[model samples]
Target: PISAAAFGVAGPIVNGVAKITNLSWTIDQIEVAHALDLAADKVQLLNDLEAMATAVPFLLPEDVQTLNTAEPVAQRPIAVVAPGTGLGEAFLTWNGRRYVAFPSEGGHADFAPGDSLQLRLLNYLAPQYGHVSVERVCSGIGIPNLYAFLRDEKIAEEPQWLREMMDQVDDIVPVIIQHAFDKAAAVPICVQTMEMFAHILAAEAGNMALKLLSRGGVYLGGGLPPRILPMLQAPRFMELFYGKGRFAQLMAQIPVYIILNQRTGLLGAGYAALALDESL
Candidate 1:
């Protein structure tokens, strides 16, 4: 028999109600509790990223690919930065005997360029997107923006074949990523776009780590990270991540891992449900 229920949703939760972002669905804890024959308090809704953060303590050796080998500080805050359709951020902090997950909208925070090129990228985007957030150059949707910037700036030439291919697709991210990995084909523009993407992602991950001082580790979750594993493994990514001046040494000690398990969010939701049951 089900004693409690928990859900990891993609939107903010207010007063036990969640309105899913980019979707036309509204979830109410009272409705869910009534339908499940449980008390309202027994049902809980968490932002999707928070659920992923909750599962960090439960991740197995095979569930992730290590990016850094630094030792984790016991029970210190752990941060999660995921770049999927959009950038999602979350963290877990020790709460007495357990780690409690918290969601963040840090991805929507103002973007600060880490270098000259990025400053140029920002200037190029600001006129088009009045308030360019980190998500503007770090997520799946952001790939095209990077690609277009490089192309228009003449930093890289966009091949006619790739342009034709992009024209045929409704979503250009996969096309860009696929060509970026095509070593034999050597798509310069795609490669440049992906490199920029990795740099921005690494910088943002470092920003999150610094903000929370997540000595427990930083986990990279989301659809994009897994697909671009090679790029993240490249030395350039770590270079950008560790470019925090005096804090560079500190960032190096915060272990980083890329989540490979697709069911992490589900596992986290189950953990949350179990916690709910235990409290009752």
Candidate 2:
């Protein structure tokens, strides 16, 4: 018989109930426990990023691609920054015996431009979204915003055929990314959009590294990173990451990796469940 259950939800958990972000579903601990015929205390819910964090320590070499080769400090804090439909952030801290994963809404935190172009992007978005968060300029949803800003500002010319294709698709991110990767028939605007996206992602990853002092490492997870591995592996991405004025050296020493395992969250949920059972 199952002694406990754990779920990694894409939202905040407050008093054991979670209202999924960008969705209308609500998950309650008591409701889940009753459905599974388990005691309420045996059910645990974690923010999706937190669940991803719990599995970081157990990842095999084959499960990740190293981006930074800095030696990790044993038992130091680790941070996870995932840019999927929205940005998700989490961290793990050593608690004497084991690392404890904690969830954060850092993705929703305010966006701070690191350069003049980014500052212009901020000003361009301010009128539309008064409180523009990093997610506004850095995730899957944010990709189109970048594309539109560039197109409108005439930074890059959007080809007529590409414009027609974008109009047909309900979600334009895949189209943009596809053209960006197509070397033979690459779209200039698409390329520019992805470049800006990569820059924002690197800067934010660096920000998290500094905030938590994650000497253990910083893991980049989610659907997008693996898909755009080439873009991320580019030199410019690391340059923006290491642009943290005084702490540039510290950022360089922090190991950065891309999580290639798609099942990491499931693996993490299993680990969380096992831990809950052991605590009983």
Candidate 3:
């Protein structure tokens, strides 16, 4: 709104509650109000993730997940996905015409990798990670460790140049992914690591969808998917997603979507507050 204000496209900033979730500082709410010249009660406290959750119902069909069928929603569940520091999972239950969404701390849940390769990954990661949680392995901050593991496993061979490139950087997951997609064959190891990581992600997403019985299909939301749309489109995701053996038939009926927009959470939060206000 700052730019809008300068252009006379918007009015003066009004009193509205804003929750600063990512801050470590103890927000003296009253102090912030005085500094911003706003009323104390005008500001509120909430997690940004929570705000993202609130946007669920307000999302356009494209913004949310829709299953394989053209028919209306049958007996099943709805799932929400948001990837930032870690992946966030949420679900909504429909009771007749009314629906309710609930939050979860699933990101902190244990990393359950399927098959022996992933088992090796967990074993390799466990010595350092002790108990591996999803966030510790799958996030922007955590992927470097995975890449290092790949280097050791000979899953992705990095030349002196790339090796030096990675050594200097703390997070190399993006580069690793790029290399995998671009030079997976030329760099056999990067290919394996990237493919394995893709499998792991698909496995995790499938686990979420199945456990939630996400009959509404699965929606992918996060910073990485938008950046890696083509890679995300790889058959590896679909292969792992439907690798549930006998249940594979059931899963195939589910469709998956990648959300490309970044403001989804903000939109969800605003919708939530507005609804809450109206209800009040």
Candidate 4:
């Protein structure tokens, strides 16, 4: 018989009910147990990023590409930040027996512009969003928002073909990303859009490392990071990451990597289930 079960939701879980951030459905532990014909106490709910953090220690070298190897201090806290449909943030800390994942809503925090261009972009978005969060300019949706800024603000020309292509597509995020990676006949605006995305992402990641003092390392776990490896490797990304005034040296010492395994969250949930069963 199944002794326990675990689930990683893409939102906050409170009182055994998960209010998924991007989805309409609410996940209740009791409902999940009743549906599966298991005891309610045997099921556990965790934020998706938290579950992904659980799989960090178990990830193989081949599962990640190191951007920095600053020598992670053993047993120190580790941070995970992902930008997909929405941004997600989490951390893991050793608790004697094992590392425990802690979920956070840090992604929704206010967006801090790092340059004049970023400030202009923020001003452009302020009217539309009222309170521009990091997720507004860092996630999948943020790509288009950034793209629109380039075009609408006269920073880049928006050709008719690109406009038509985007209008016909169900999701312009992937289309924009594809054009960004296409150097041969690339759309200049798309390329710039992705560049801006990388800048903001790197900046936010550095902020996360500083906030948590994650000397264990900072891992990027998201659908976009792995696909945009070349863009991420650009010197501009690291430059922004190391832009911290007095703490640039400390930021330079923080190891950073891209989590290649997309199943990290599921794998972490499995470990959570094992942990729960062992305790029982």
lDDT of all predictions: 0.92, 0.91, 0.62, 0.90
Off by over 4 Å in 2: none
TM-score (C-alpha, index-matched) for candidate 3: 0.76
What is the model-wide C-alpha lDDT for candidate 4? 0.90
List candidate 4 stretches off by more than 4 Å.
Answer: none
Q: What tens digits encode model 1's per-residue C-alpha lDDT throughout 1-280?
A: 7999999999999988999998999999899999999998888998899889899999999999999779899989999999999999999999999999999899999989988988999999999999999999999878899999999999899888888988998999999998899878858888889989999999999999999999999999999999989999999888888889999999999999999998899999989999999656
Please give, for residues 158-203, the per-residue lDDT of candidate 2 as tens digits: 8898889889989999999999999798888888899999999999
- Tens-place lDDT per residue, model 3, 1-280, is 1111000000112233333335433445456556656455544333445555555556676664432343325545766665555767666677676455566777778998788877777888898868898776666655666677777887666688778777787667766767766843445555666566566667777888789878765666667667656556776678788789889987787767776668876676555444434234
- Give residue 183's lDDT in candidate 1 (0 to 100): 73
Please name the candidate that would achieve the greatest lDDT relative to the true structure.
1
RMSD of 4: 1.5
Models 1 onward score TM values of: 0.98, 0.96, 0.76, 0.96
Please give, for residues 122-236, the per-residue lDDT of candidate 4 as tens digits. Answer: 9999999999999999998788899999999999998899899888979999888888888688889888999999999999999999998999999999898998999888888
User: Over 4 Å off in model 3, which ranges?
Assistant: 1-23, 27-46, 61-76, 95-99, 183-189
Residue 29, candidate 4: Cα error in Å is 1.0
| Candidate 1 wrongly placed segments (more than 4 Å) | none
For model 3, give the 10-residue run with minimal summed lDDT.
Answer: 1-10
